[model samples]
Target: MKSDRPSHEDFPHFQTLNTRWMDNDLYGHINNVTYYAYFDTVVNRYLIDAGGLDIHSGPVIAYVVSSGCDYFRSAAYPQVLEIGLRVTKLGNSSVTYSLGVFAQGEEALLACGQFVHVFVDRARETPVPIPATLRAALEPLCAPG
Candidate 1:
C-alpha cells in the first residue's frame, strides 16, 4: 500500500539517526520494529533536552497511545539513518509527531510514520496539559507543513 507514496521531502523537519548492529534482523537488514524505536528515541531525546523533561521525577510525563510506520526502502546494519521529525498537531494533552527515516545523507526517506503521545500526570494515570517548558520547546517545531 505504501509503495506508491511520494518522497519524504513532501514533509517537514529532519533528524538524522545511525543504525546499530543490534538493529539488524535475521534476514540481515534492519528490523521493521527498530525504526519505531529510533523514532521514539530521537523525539524523546530532543524533547528531554530542549523541553527540560525529567523522566525520573518530573510531575508530567507523556504516554504513547498510538504509533505506526511505513517502509519505503530497506536499511541495513552499519548505516547512518537520517530521521526527519516534526509536530503535525498539538492538542491539549496529545501531540502527533511525524518522522521520516533516511539513510545517511540521502534526501529521501526509507520509512515514515506518525507517533502520538498523550501528556499526563504519571501518578494519576490521566491526561494533563503539556507543561509550559515543554510547550515552549515544541513551539519551534510546530510550524505548519
Candidate 2:
C-alpha cells in the first residue's frame, strides 16, 4: 500500500469508533469485513439520530444499495479509530457516503470506503424523495464544489 494518507480536511464529519477484541481475525488483525461494519455504524448512527429515521416504524427507510472499501493499513484490537465521513452524492432518493477510518489522532487513514443508500417507502418498497428532515441533516455533509 502507498504511504500517502488523506488529510483530515478531506473529510467533513467525524466519529470515534472503538475496535473490539472480537473484531480481529485469526490472522491477528482486524478483518477486512469489519471495516464495512465500522462504515455502517458511523453513517447509520448519524441518520438514525440526526435524520430522525425510525428504524422500526418510519414510513420511509434507507437501504444499502452498494458498498466498497480499500485498506491502506492494518487496524488491530484495543485501538480507537476516528471515522471521518461525508456525502459524495445526494440524489432524489439516494445518497452516497464516503468514509475514512484512521487510528485515533492519526492524520493518515487506515481504510476508506463508501456506502450508497436508496431511500424508499417501507410499505411499497418504492423509491421516494428524500425526507426534508433527512435532507436538512445531510446537507452539511454533502460534498463541496
Candidate 3:
C-alpha cells in the first residue's frame, strides 16, 4: 500500500522541537495527546514571531476551535521533531493549518494533522477578521485547495 503522509516539502514553515522524557507513555512512545501540543506550539510560535501576535495583550487572539491528527509511526523520547506547517484555508475569521511531524534529518512524516483557529476579540470573545499583520504572514503559507 502507498503512504498518504505528506513530506517536508509540503510545508513552508518549520520548527524544531525536542521531546521530553515526560512526553513518553507506558507504551514507550510519545503519547498521542502530545502530538497536539506540538501542533499548538509550532502554530503559536509562528504567530508570535512572524505575525506579531501578542499573546498577553493583543487585542485580537486566535482560539483553536478544531484540531485532529493521524499517526503513521511512533516517536520516542529524546528524538528531535521537525514540525512543518502550512496554511490550507485562510478565511476572514478562521485559518486552517496543515502540519507534518518528522524526525530530524528525515524527509517522511511520522504524523500529520490540521488545526483550525478562529480569530476573535480578546475581550468580547466574538469572531473577528484576522488581523492584517497576521494575515500577511499567513499568506505565504496558504496553499490552493
Q: Judging by lDDT against the true structure, name the best candidate.
A: 3
TM-score of each: 0.89, 0.94, 0.96
Give one digit per residue, the lDDT tens place, for model 3 in 1-145: 7556667887989999999999999999999999999999999999999999999998999999999999988999999999999999999999999999999999878999999999999999999999999999999998756
Per-residue lDDT for 1-145 in model 2, tens only?
7444455787888999899999999999999999989988998899988889888999999899899998888999999999999998999999999898999998877888988999999999999999999999899998776
Name model 2 segments beyond 4 Å from true. Answer: 1-5
Question: Pairs clashing in candidate 3?
Answer: none
Candidate lDDT values, in order: 0.83, 0.90, 0.94
Ranking of all predicted structures according to TM-score, beginning with the best and ending with the worst: 3, 2, 1
Answer with 2 or 3, whichever has the higher lDDT. 3
Question: Of models 1 and 3, which has the larger TM-score?
Answer: 3
Model 1: weakest 10-residue lDDT segment is 3-12
